[model samples]
Target chain A: EAGVVQSPRYKIIEKKQPVAFWCNPISGHNTLYWYLQNLGQGPELLIRYENEEAVDDSQLPKDRFSAERLKGVDSTLKIQPAELGDSAVYLCASSLQGQETQYFGPGTRLLVL
Target chain B: GIQVEQSPPDLILQEGANSTLRCNFSDSVNNLQWFHQNPWGQLINLFYIPSGTKQNGRLSATTVATERYSLLYISSSQTTDSGVYFCAVDEYGNKLVFGAGTILRVKS
Candidate 1:
């Protein structure tokens, strides 16, 4: 089966610009997650969705970052007026409900100048 | 929140050599996973070993849940095996806490 898919593998924007990343989870997977990875560091959870409900988003920066999984199969993470610190790799992963194994996409590399 | 620590932080090996990576966690966990992030930034699942041992080709992993530690073994390493290896644990069964990761460089 195909793995999780993400769009616009690489994006570049100036500081204070708006940017968005999209993700498509694997088939039949009921749990989707978004993570941010800085250089030389492991990924940190940003948001998680169980079906269409966001079960965890405490780590997300609500002031500038927002995410939604409307139909439950696809998700979009947005950053409005992104800051220079917002430059990082945005990764999307999915797994079957109740399963701990998660598969990740190639990730979207964002660079804010 | 739980703490995860990885040892060595970096490893360098020549082709055909073998090496081991270690991960130590601070609390009990329901799920543990090993992942390899390629130079292109794609995370590939290496193993989902919550307990016991599992082997796949040249790679193998063992997790001692009771001890709150895991080990990943790579045998006869190749240049392609060079990447960052991460150990992640889910204490509540949903959120994963990851270690800083071990950077591996296999020179051919």
Candidate 2:
């Protein structure tokens, strides 16, 4: 099966501008996830979806960051009025089940100037 | 929220050498996994071992769930092994908390 797919492998924007990232999970995978990884840091969970239902998003900065999985097969993560601190790599992953091994995609690297 | 810690934040080794990376969790978790992040930022799952030991080729991993720690062993390392190794865990749902990772550099 193909691995998770993400769009616009790299993005650059100015502060206060909005940026969006897209993700397409592997075929047959029921779980999707979005994570943010700052320079020199590991990926931190931003949101998790189980077939179109976002089950975990406590860590997400709701005021500026929002995510949606409309059809359960694809997802979109957006950052409004992006800040310098929001410059990071956004990663997407998928799994066959809730507790199964997760497969990740080549992250979308964002740079906010 | 859970806390995950990885050891030896940075490591350097010569080709044909061996190394071990570790991960420790602050609380009990039913799920644990190891992954390798390449320079391009793709995470490849290494192992999904909540307990016991598993060996694949020259790579091996052991997890002691009761103690909430895991070890990843690489034998006769190669330049291809140079990258960041990360450990992730989750309690109830599939949401995972990842460790900072162990950056390994294997020189030939």
Candidate 3:
């Protein structure tokens, strides 16, 4: 079976520009998550979706970050007016309903200058 | 919110050496996992052992839920095992709290 897939494995943008990352979870997985990982640190959850409904997004920076999981399969996370601190890896993961083992994608590395 | 801490932030070993990584959590949890972030930046799930012990190939992990700690054992390590190992736990079974991670380098 195919694992989770993400688009634009790498991206570079100037500060204040808008950027977006897309993700497609594994087949039949009903739970999806978006995480941000900085240099020398573990990933931190930004948002989580349960079949199109965002159940946990408290860690997301609503001031400039927004995410959507339409139809409950694919998800897109966007950052408006990107900042230097936003330069990091954006990872997408998915798991079966109520299952804790999450399968991750290759991830999108964004570099904001 | 729960806190996760990993000890020996960095470790270097020869290809044939063995090592143990530890992870400690502040609160009780029912969901715990170990992940390896490769040099190419892929997060690979190594184990989903919230309790008990599990072994796969040269790697084994044991989680003692009662003590709020987990151990990852890498025996006869290979150069390919160089990367950062992360331990994450979820108290509510949804959102995971991750440790700072342990960086390991296996020399050839």
Docking class of 2: high
In angstroms and one decimal each, the interface RMSD of every candidate reads: 0.6, 0.8, 0.6
Which is superior by lDDT, 2 or 3?
Answer: 3
Q: What tens-digit string does per-residue lDDT give for candidate 1 at A49-98?
A: 99999999999999999999998899999999999999999999999998
Q: Rank the candidates by lDDT, best first.
A: 3, 1, 2
**Per-candidate DockQ versus the true complex?**
0.91, 0.86, 0.91
- Candidate 1 has what TM-score? 0.98
Better of 1 and 2 by lDDT: 1
Kindly list the per-residue Cα lDDT of model 3 for residues B48-93, writing each as its tens digit: 9999999999999999999999999999999999999999999995
Ranked by TM-score, the better of candidates 2 and 3 is 3
Predicted candidate 2 versus true structure: per-residue lDDT over A1-113, tens digit per residue: 67899998999999999999999999989899999999888898889898999988998999999999988899999999899999899999998874569989999999999
Model 3: per-residue Cα lDDT over A24-96, one tens digit each: 9999999999999999998999999999999999999999999999999999999998999999999999999
Give the runs in model 3 whose Cα sits over 4 Å from its true position. none
Worst 10 residues of 2 chain A by lDDT: A94-103
Residue B4 of model 1, lDDT score: 97
What TM-score fits each model?
0.98, 0.97, 0.98
